[model samples]
Target: MKFIEEVVVEEFLPTFRSMLAGELRERGLTQSEVAELLGISQSAVSKYAHGDVDINDAVADDERVRETVERLADGLETGDMSRVQALVEAEILIRKLERGDLLANLHEAAFPPLSDHEGPLDIHDPEGDLRTTERVLSSVRRGVRTLENTSGFAALIPAVGSNLVEALPDADGIDDVAAIPGRILDIKGQATVPGDPEFGVSEHVASVLLAARAAGSDARAALNVRYDEDVVAKLDAAGYETVEFDAEADVESAIAEALESNPQPDVLYQTGGFGIEPVVYLLGADAGVVVGTVRDLV
Candidate 1:
């Protein structure tokens, strides 16, 4: 897919700049770190932070910087701060691309385009409504990258890819998923996890599971599995606590039941073609990270 440069931008620069400032603040990342990541000076990052520098000038001779900036601009157009966050993450992504720094390093990283996937809100909680849809998009992209780097599950990433496509992702679409961050699983049908049967598995389920596993939860952490009886039985046999739920179950009821009964934060995995609404329901409004699949794009 083409980058954001393909889109018209005369009226969007100010909005993008505003987004850039907020993204730096939200991530608790400093201008110094951005400078270091881009192989530049702290003053440069500070200059950009204070609107005293130009992003183009900072990385004028760097191809990677230009490419990253264009990609970030595409994300900014979504008008989602989380998209900005996703574009800025330095942990898994390369800090320096070619001679340029990551988009988050410059002013351009601040404003990613907004998207319509603004997920659902929880009624009992006031925090659910405050989250930006960009965050959900960022979380999903991070989850996908983490899954690719993990050692064991080579078999599942492709399934995750399929789920991502069916979900109509702007974050992990081929254009962005393979750029600066570069996924470990870039092939069409390679398994990230060994010996896992591919017949019954789906990409969305595998992607979420792999991402959750990478996020440092084992069987010890509270995990809620939503799937059909057969899938649940299999997971139960594998030591996962499986809850039998219809794919069409009310999202609120499912989340309340899972959370109230569990007494701890849990990694929720819904299988058997469950939709995206449940993901939004469970992750809620103040989600730090969430990974799940939908049979159809929301």
Candidate 2:
């Protein structure tokens, strides 16, 4: 049950901070100055200087980490880099190293199960597109968890089932959306997720999200639930922008037309047609927000 962040705090930060302290000292900075620059206690700096802290050899010996330390140390010593800029540079390097680099190896050492994953873990890449996509997936997972725990969430599931979906920042099609492989359904009074979430698993909700994006909505996440007029009125009274589309028409065109009138709607609903189930979609900036809106309905 250990998190990768625990490995980073216990292993990477100590080793990197100690090395940076040493480098700054060698560049003629006094212990007090180094402590001040590194934002650490003077005593902590003393421990790093006196070899009291254990350095992770893998991190200390990495060329990129070593170069970052040297560069920051030189900049700090010569007044070329402000403390804030030095901190940002070091942070960026740490993120770069965490993306299937040295820090990821250290993470594998701490949690062996991660080694079995399908591809390199880019969970720590703060600015990478992969990280952004992973975050969307994580938000959807949290939303699903919230719904599963809610006492009557299963009652909200449509006969066709429901799915929560989120699109990548630059999604082009269904393949770029993360969703449950099978729709969520109410089984024996419980909300059940049949399988793990994967890209391109959903067709209906994904198309709606893509259409919303194409229609210039900033929302990146959406969730579908059984529709009710009372629920729509509640959402509208609560200040959520609502739009209606024809269920009998093409889904994409219906959404486009609805959004063409209201560019940024928080809720989209359709009246049931013959043999078609009516559904209401909650939309927001991320899955967590979308789920929160659904929670409000509960």
Candidate 3:
């Protein structure tokens, strides 16, 4: 009888432990010290040290995982955040990720028979928006990484620089959206991220996203790139619905009217105005899928 929690214990735990152990070691902790800090055996820490533990790439690559491990490792080393708090933090992330999220997806993939089920969001809501905030940050980071890694994406950055953003579920204002601070700039044919993803840092993309949502679009994520007639043609050729809006008009009303003909557009663009730079906005269910669609263009 295999349970979902069993999947967590068997699959997620090892990778998480290994990462935490490695982080501690890098901070100059001995194997015995790491084992003590992590509440694990020295043998297990040694195994982790030797790379004997197989890691889930998806989990390891998650920004939340990296952040949490570093945070906890630092706490364990210098005694900032308590171990109990660290455990609670990790547990919160796991619970959050399991609910119709990455861990749940992994669980369903591991046992195809229960593919239709995604765990409900419950248990505890410690720090009301903590989990949700982390999820959005992680999603944006993933999308930004996708754009950074994709060849030719740098050329897509608009003159004003680009920003990748994701709105929280039922987001009503700019504060509810998370985005890269400042902007992702193009430097020497490379997309350079300025800082980590944070809430309410983006005004332009977030406004557009909220406007699109207010116009009845279900998209929660949006990314902007340099506008080009060829790019629009490629998006149309790729079977994505494209719409045009007036760049100088009221952005909310402009977007609202634009989506009227094609309510669920995959792409929205505005041509250059007297001073406004031309740009294209890609919208989707989440940051990852939006980035994937952009990847298709590449």
Q: What's each prediction's TM-score?
A: 0.25, 0.62, 0.59
- Deviation (Å) of 210 in candidate 2: 0.9
* Tens-place lDDT digits, model 2, residues 48-100: 99999988888888898889989989998899999999989988987787787
Per-model lDDT: 0.34, 0.87, 0.87
Residue 159, candidate 2: Cα error in Å is 0.3
Question: For model 2, how many clashes?
Answer: 0
Worst 10 residues of 3 by lDDT: 115-124
What's the C-alpha lDDT at position 163 in model 1? 32
Q: Give the TM-score of candidate 3.
A: 0.59
Report the candidate with higher lDDT, 1 versus 2: 2
CA RMSD per model (angstroms) = 18.7, 7.2, 15.9
TM-score result, candidate 2: 0.62
lDDT of 3 at 224: 94
| Model 2: lowest-lDDT 10 consecutive positions | 116-125
